[model samples]
Target: MNIKSILAKPFAKTVVAKIYRQSNNAVKVQQNLMQKLLSQAAHTAFGKDHNFSEIKSYEDFKKEVPICDYEALKPYVERVVNGEKDVLWKGQPLYFAKTSGTTSGIKYIPLTKESMPTHISGAKNALLHYIDETQNADFLGGKMIFLQGSPELGDTNGIKTGRLSGISAHYVPKYLMKNRLPSWETNCIEDWETKVEAVIDETIHENMTLIGGIPSWVQMYFERIVERTGKKVGEVFPNFNLFVYGGVNYEPYRNKFEDLIGRKVDAIELYPASEGFISYQDSQDENGMLLLVNNGIFYEFIPSEEFFDENPTRISIANVEVGVNYVIILNTNAGLWGYNIGDTVEFVSLNPPRIVVTGRIKHFISAFGEHVIGKEVERAINSQTENTSISINEFTVAPQITPVAGLPYHEWFIEFENEPEDLMVFAQKIDESLQQQNTYYFDLISGKVLQPLKITVIEKGGFNNYMKSVGKLGGQNKVPRLSNDRKIADELSKFQQK
Candidate 1:
């Protein structure tokens, strides 16, 4: 056995054991974690204000602290950004992860010394768990390229600020630095196009075994490598075996990636946010990702159907049922209490609770009251594509509310690497598939309340160009897949017209 494999054996075994133990006692583990977080922050201003001392259990805590979004906690976050110590967490945060806001301009999320480990440790344990399950520690024997944002951090008051990936880049372990690709100079390039070229130039000939990044950006790298080397990904990196990805759905890009690599490879999905690393794919035998119960973040679930209600019921891990979509609420050691990160997930397993990211709370199509979500749209596309020979690159759906003289309809903007031979038939298949998945959507179409879905084949690179124009081309930035309004659709229309 290789040295890397030998060294990993103990760590991997421990991680697998912890996962198994925690899964069996998930409710108890979550309860203990929740108490620990609350007690840790009890002396802080937020804690005092929320009467954390008086809170003894999940019920007491929920009643004491109100569920909040970024806007609701913006004031406390601003205080932290302005050099206030112990305003949220116990001390000044080590850094602020600046995330793009949906309604607001920019959100500065605090990352403390206590919370940083949740991100790093969760990631390390994810790979360790994978290694344990597959007994494939040989991946540790080869280089792994992490396509991350620039490591050059900007300052917000006294605290450092940058994208989460950029912040994480600074913390790459010293041992792995030798195997990590792309010099610091290359990561700091800022412009994705330039950085991608730099990455391709630096690692085209390296003995790479793993590639980790968002699917779209990594696909961009693969496309460039293919164009430059005139070889499939397998030929360029003979040892490449694992693809680790998150931040967006991987279904649409799966076929395209397999084609580029010239064969199928193992993939691991992660559910990480600027807030924390929530979950990761542990067992290939399981369909859903295992929840990080022992992580520093404490979790609660509010059913998606009741999310907009004035006072929705919040259920703890003990009460969460399988197959119900829930908006996740968090109370973290970073000093966030009852914060809603706007993402939605559905529990697929209850024993060792596992979840699937269903969609964003704000990212849905319900303009005409037929509430279609990201999962539905992705499922429709995947189902239809499976029956055809075409490959999808990227796609987004938005309701076209304004029609010259007909019923309103949903408009799809798609970028295809291989265009379908029968575009009209492909569009019809998608419409039919969507109808089958969502009863409300089917009713809208069947009753002639809404027109059939319209497909617009965007020129190749249109989505990338649009993202670049808007300064969100890479590093956890993704094109919103479904929207009730035409903001993204109209913007994409301009690109299509060109």
Candidate 2:
């Protein structure tokens, strides 16, 4: 073993052990974190406004602070944007993670000095956990690539601002600098296609051992490598054994990914957002990621089914139950209190608070009173494709309420890498799986209120073309897995197979 690998083993073990111990007392750790956050921010504008000084317990907190999406919190965020110190948190934010929002044109999420370390440490510990379990620190000895946004920062009201991934680029540990690939110059290229080409040119022949990115973007990179060298990714980088990914479910893309790599490789899932790094996979044998309870954030959950109801039941980690989908809320050291980041999750293990991200609160199809979430559709597609030759490049679902003919149905736009022999049979299988998982959907189909879901073949590069048309071609942007309306489906119609 090389020097880095040798050193990494001990460090990895230490971190993993620390995480295990902290997770064992998850509720207490979160309660303590909540107190710390309230006490530290008590004098701030938001804290004072919410009577943070009088809030002695979680119940008091819930009664004092109302849940806030970006619009609800915009007034305070505006003050922070105009360079107000102690407006939200204790002092001026270190950086603003600029992200595109649906209703709000551009969102500026603060990254305070206290909360920034959690983002870096969360990713670091995920790998360390893998190393501790598998004794596979050998990857640390070879080149690593994280396909991310440009590290370029732009000023927003005198605060350094960039995409969350770009901000994270500035914090890559010194130890990994030697092994990190795609030279700094290549990473700074703004155009994703250009950046990918440059990244290929820079690291195509290097001893790359790990690759990380959103599944769709990484698929493009893998295809580029194969096109350029007429070799599978595994052949190009024999040591590349780990793929770290986030932002979307990886199961639907697994068959295509393994096909491109030419073998099965280990992967780590991360639940991160501009707001905070909430969880990371801690074990290869586990079903979900370990929640960061002791991190500088306190969490709340509103049952997903009741999320739209008036006065939803919001509970702490201590009250969460396994298998129940809940919309996650955050109160972070960054000064975001009772913040709704929109992601929904389900606890797989409540003892140590391991969670699987189910879907986004807004990213679902309930057009026919049958709520089909991202997780359900992803599960349905994967259920059909597993152990089969069928592999898809990418897909999205939308409600076809008023079709040219026949009853209303869910339309699935799919870009197939390897199409199944019988398209109708494949669609039937996926539809059946989806129905089984969602009782409402099953009832609707049985009642003749909706027809079976239809699959529309999207020609190669269709999704990318659609993303490009909207100026979100790459870097941290992903197509929502499902939509209630036909906005995306209408745009994708031109690319559909004849």
Candidate 3:
């Protein structure tokens, strides 16, 4: 056993606190930790499989551990679909968090016990930072209503076979066995409808003060509140102090929610996923402080140029510069040594580098926080699109709120070879594939959290013209890997006009 691992016993919080205190920028501390992890993780994750434990130098780690999409992780996932374990790691993975990756298909991200605390502690620290910033001790004193996943703890076909944020939410705490307050723990919500109802009933008239979660979902919960009680949102919950959300951009969804509630949205950013809380916005003015779980993950940054570099490799975070985008490389506890997270981000500052996520490294749209990536989207469309002879040369997706205003839906601009006999039906199939793969998408739609889906079938050669305008029609860059909402859609529309 690697004795160096013991320093991580308390998930390295003191070290993080120390880093926070001593370092002027996050760069110095990050490099120090990487130097330690690069040497140690090789032994910690040794001999798990070809997929796990492949770290030599930080550069080798980046090259060898190729970027993975959800579909790429499917073979390991099929085992979870069949209730098998030890495939993703040496030991049994306690639960799986179903993240709807950039793909229209699902990415079931596995969260093991070792890496879970970092997630929970990061979350707690985020909250602590919030309280510190706001100077509100009562934030946690009142009922903390998190508009999040199913309040289930045990595993019973729980997101094992299918996609569900509720199920994924359930696994988060269990994986981080230490962070949770055991006495405060509740029942495993096996039934979806019942679980939601329970969550609703629990929060409705109670002293639900500190509200947290995605703005869209919080709006969904607000709708549920409005639906269950004839009273407008304001009359029911006058005590609500704050709202927290992440996953999707909040600017568009904010005004509508505020109008109904008779309150300005006091929203905060969260960098959470099915795997863990990767980062969190610490203060009102500051960008999200990357609480590097120094013990749990070894960090590496690949130059944004590395995407075009013939000899691309991961570089130390110590050496990264602000304003440059880099593909995030992670060497985490769950036997994943020197892994590239496939997401892209940039540092706002070097001293405790506050990172703002630019987008996915590989093309993928996370219109929702489902963590969708290029391959999963491609896989979902390729087999079916190819069979139908509707050759999808290229595409872009944006969250269009026009259908129901606050309730957004994925708007697809398809460049198809042939027009479908039943275009609506074709769109339905696409929606079905996505919904089946990503349960969270289905949940929001079915629950009326979002609007009815819309598909805009564009004219042939739309993508080519679109690419040309971007001045990246040919080489490594074709079009964006992902587009979130109206901004990208408008750009695409302008190109279409040309």
Candidate 4:
């Protein structure tokens, strides 16, 4: 066995056993974690302001700290940026994860020493779990690539700042250094199109065994590889067997991905954000990611339906129920208090606290009082297209309030690899599936308030073109599956078929 795999086997055994123990006692562990976080930060600036010392329970916490998005927390973040110590966390943040925000412009999320290791360990444990289950560690000996942001960091105030993926680039385990590619020079290229070309140049002949990234960007890389070699990815790298992805759902792109690789491969999903590494897929046989309950963050949930209410019903992780959609909130060791990162989730298995990301709280179609989420659209399309030759490249949904004729409808803009034989039939099937899942949508259609959803075909390369036009072409940028407004739909109209 290779050195990495040999060391991994025993380590995986020990860690997996510990994980089982922790998960079996999830409620107790989470409660303990919450207390620990409160104790640790009880002396910080934010702690004093919020009266964290007197808060002895989750109820007290909810009353003490108001739930906040980046904007709400911006005042404290501004203090941190001005070189204030012990403001958010205990000391100066180790790094600021710089991300573009729509309304707020540039946002800088804190990453402290206390919370950084979880990001690395979360990813590591996922791979170890896969190895433990499948006894397949052969990929360790071959090159692995994670198509990420430019590793070249910029300075903000006195702290290093970059994309979360870029910040993570500096923390790759020493053991995998020899097997990781492309080189630092290629990784530091600022422009994405240039970087992809450099990556292709550097690793075209390497035995690439594993590929990781957001599926859309990785698909671009894979397409370039195929174009260069005139062969499927599997033909070029026969041992490439694992695809690890996050940031967006992979179901819509699965058929196209498998087609590009010329075969099916094992895949792992991760739930990560600039705020923290929340969860990772723990088993190849499982459908959902195992929530990292014992990690450095304490989680809270609010029912998605009540999210915009004046006083939403906030509950601790202990009270979360299966099959209910929730907007996840974070109170982390990094000093974020009652932070809402905006993603929604649904618990599928509460035994070990496994969850499927349902959608974003703000990213949905609620026009006409039909609260249609990303998961519904994804499920609708996947159910109809599965086992058929109709493969979607990308798609998004938006409400069409004022059609030239007839009632308003939900418009699906799809970029297809292979169009269905009957477009009307395909649209009907998806609309039927959606109606069955969402009662509000069903009522709208049944009551003649809205017409059945319509499909608008986007020309090939249209989505990519739109992304490029927005200057968010690659690396963690993904099109929201559905939106309440026509902002994206109006932009995509430029590429729609006549």
Q: Give all TM-scores, in the order shown.
A: 0.97, 0.99, 0.59, 0.99
Candidate 1 weakest ten by summed lDDT: 383-392
lDDT (tens digit, per residue) of candidate 3 on 24-139: 55555555555554444333223344422444455555555555445565666567556565555545555565544445355556666776666666665665555555555444
Tens digit of per-residue lDDT, candidate 2, span 1-498: 799889888999998888888999988998998999999999999999999999999999999999989989999999999999998998899999999899998999999999999999999999999999999989988999999998889998889999999999999999789889888888999898998999999899899999999999999999999999999999999999999999998899999999999999999998889999999999999899999998888999999999889999999988989999999999998989899999999999987889999999999999989989989999999998898889999999999999999999999999999999999999999999999999999999999999999999999999999999999998999999999999999999889977
Candidate 4 residues 301-396, lDDT tens each? 999999999999999888999999999999998889999999999999888899999999999998889999999999999998888889988999
Better of 1 and 3 by lDDT: 1
Show the lowest summed lDDT stretch of 10 residues, model 4: 1-10
Could you give the C-alpha RMSD of every candidate to the true structure, in order shown? 1.4, 0.8, 15.3, 0.9
Local distance difference test values of all predictions, in order: 0.89, 0.93, 0.56, 0.92
Candidate 2, residue 191: Cα displacement in angstroms equals 1.0
Best by lDDT: 2
